[model samples]
Target: MNEVLIITGACGVGKTATARVWAKAKQGVAIETDYFTEWIYDDSLERFTREEEKLVANLSLVTAKEYLAQKMPVAIEGVWSPYGLSLLHSGLKKKAKNAKLKFVWLYCEISENHRRDELRVSENQMKQRVDIVSQQLQSYHWENYVHHIDTTYLTLPETLAAIESK
Candidate 1:
């Protein structure tokens, strides 16, 4: 059976990079929600609203299901809220009923987040997003069903190991 993996985190938390490597390792496909959001926003908006996030979540989950139905393992990366994740979890199970579904939220220290954001390419760099997303994640109450990984001190491989274990 195929698998649906949701690799989520605040901006600059390496969600996209991790999903790419994970997809390669598992011989699956990786979908980045940012690209979808970019398209919806016409690539002009620096940040998206909650309503927009909901749209992106639905769109990405539907896309993931399409791939999973074909026996292709899928990894979707984004910054989704608890409500959004809950919906995605259910949506992924639709087409791939027998597939394994997992959600991993990667996070790091505020300073580390800032540093990482700066290290990213100028075009994709997100300065305020790092802090804004981090704060939102902290204030929100996430469901215990999801795996929360603090990647402040972990390397990419180590982070991947933790996610796999979860």
Candidate 2:
């Protein structure tokens, strides 16, 4: 069946990498919402606000729907909130009801997250608590569609296996 993989997490959690691999495997497109978010990023804010999420989700919904309409699987990686997913999920379902919707929420130890952040280019460096956003997400009650992945020590291939096997 055609699928839409929503790969979400905080900085340094490997969402982008995993989504890319997954998309390639399925011969699909990987939509990274970071591009959309970056366009409106204000240094004053800590992370994305609800209004920002709405804008990002709206555009992402349109993109995902377009790919799914072509009967291609899609993987979307982003730092998304549960509320944003609720909106995107509904919007996607309305347009592509038969597609399997899978949510992959990647997480890691704070220290590990920091270590990964250190490896990133200076332009993409984390300026604040990677833990805060990720932790806040962990606190929420995730539904059945969501899959939690603890990537404390896993390599990229191992991480890919974990996601695909699930």
Candidate 3:
């Protein structure tokens, strides 16, 4: 059966990279919600407002539903909380009820996140905003449903193995 994998985490936790790699390996489609949000606000908007996040989330869900309709597996990568993912989960159930849905959360130590953030080259203002948001969203709690991966000390191969083991 086709599946929908929602990959979420704080900023700099490698959600996009991991999702892309996984999708390619599995011959699935990867949707980066940040790309959708960027297309919506490609101007001087330095940060995503809650309203913008909701809009992008909706668009991402729509895209995922479309892919699943085509009998294709999909991976959605984003910095999403449980609340945000709950929205996607409900939408997917309503739109593609038969698709298996999985929620994966990638986590790493604050120091590692900060290091990755510093290594990223982006506008200084954007970097600052991402830093603030990442710090605020460093921890997440969901009861028994989330596939949590602590990527603090894992190499790329190790991380992939951990995710695939799930």
Candidate of highest lDDT: 2
Candidate 1 lDDT at 34 equals: 76
What's the lDDT for all of these models?
A: 0.82, 0.85, 0.77
Error of 3 at 11 (Å): 2.2
Please state the error at residue 48 of candidate 3 in Å.
4.0
- Give one digit per residue, the lDDT tens place, for model 1 in 1-166: 7877897788877798889989999888999887876565433434466788778888887888788767788999988888778878777767567888888889899999999889979987877767777887888788887899999998889988998998
Model 2, residue 40: displacement in angstroms?
Answer: 3.3
**Model 3 per-residue lDDT tens digits across residues 88-142:** 8788889888888888888887778777778777652345545555655654566
- Please identify model 2 stretches exceeding 4 Å from their true place: none
Off by over 4 Å in 3: 39-50, 124-126
Position 124, candidate 3: lDDT: 24
lDDT of 2 at 37: 84
Q: What residue runs in model 1 are displaced by over 4 Å at the alpha carbon?
A: 39-47
Sort all candidates by TM-score, best to worst: 2, 1, 3
lDDT agreement of model 3 with the native: 0.77
TM-score of 1: 0.90
